[model samples]
Target: LFVAGPILLVELYPARVEFAFYRMSLCTKLGGLCETDCLTFKEKTGSCRADLTPLCCRKGKKH
Candidate 1:
C-alpha cells in the first residue's frame, strides 16, 4: 500500500506541475532559514553563496 500509494500519487500529476510543487514546498521550508546569519549574509552582501539554495523571494511563477 505505501509503495503503490506514492506511485499512484506521482502518476496523478503532470511531471512539470509535480516538480514545481516539490520545489515550492522545499523553498517554503528553506525560506525560514533566510533569517539565519549565513543566508542573510549572502543575501545582503551577495557573497559566500550556496549554489544549491533557491532564493526565498522566487516562490512561484509560470514557466
Candidate 2:
C-alpha cells in the first residue's frame, strides 16, 4: 500500500504576474526592459496558474 501526506493549495498557483512586476521594477532602475503583461496580469493576483510558470509555484507554505 502507498501512503500519502496532506496536500497544500498554494502549490497550484504560479507567480508570473508577481515576477513580472518585480523583475520589471528592478530592470527599470537598471535601464533594462520593463516588460509586463498588464492585460493578463491585471486579472490575476499574487499567484497565477501553476501549469503556466514554475517560478511562482508555492505549497501554500511560507518560506
Candidate 3:
C-alpha cells in the first residue's frame, strides 16, 4: 500500500495560463511584480531579504 502525503507548493506559474500572478512565500516589502532574478539569504541573522523567495500566490485573472 502507498500513502500520498501533502503536495509541495512552490512559487511557480502554470504553463497553460497566459496571464498568471507570480507569488512569493513571504510578503515582499517591495511592491509590484516581485522578480526572482536575484535572491539572497543570511542564515546568521535568521533573515532573508532576497529579491524573491520560494513562495507562490494566486490571483484572479482576466483570461
**lDDT value, candidate 2, whole model:** 0.36
Better-scoring candidate (lDDT), 1 or 2: 1
Predicted structure with the largest TM-score when compared to the true one: 1
Off by more than 4 A, model 3 = 3-25, 30-33, 39-63
Write the residue-wise lDDT of candidate 3 on 1-63 in tens digits. 123232222223243122222222233332222333323331121223333432322232345
The model with the greatest lDDT is 1
**Residue 23's C-alpha lDDT in candidate 3?**
26
Model 1: CA > 4 A from native: 1-13, 32-55, 58-63
Please provide TM-scores, in order, for all candidate models, with all chains considered together.
0.32, 0.29, 0.16
- 14-39 per-residue lDDT for model 2 (tens digits): 45556556654554454333223334
Give every collision pair in model 1: none
Give the poorly placed runs of model 2, Cα more than 4 Å off.
Answer: 1-14, 35-63
lDDT of 3 at 60: 27
Q: How close is candidate 3 to the true structure, as a TM-score?
A: 0.16
- lDDT by residue (1-63, candidate 1, tens digit) is 989999988887676566655655665565533222433233322211233443333223235
Clashing pairs in 3: 23-57, 25-55
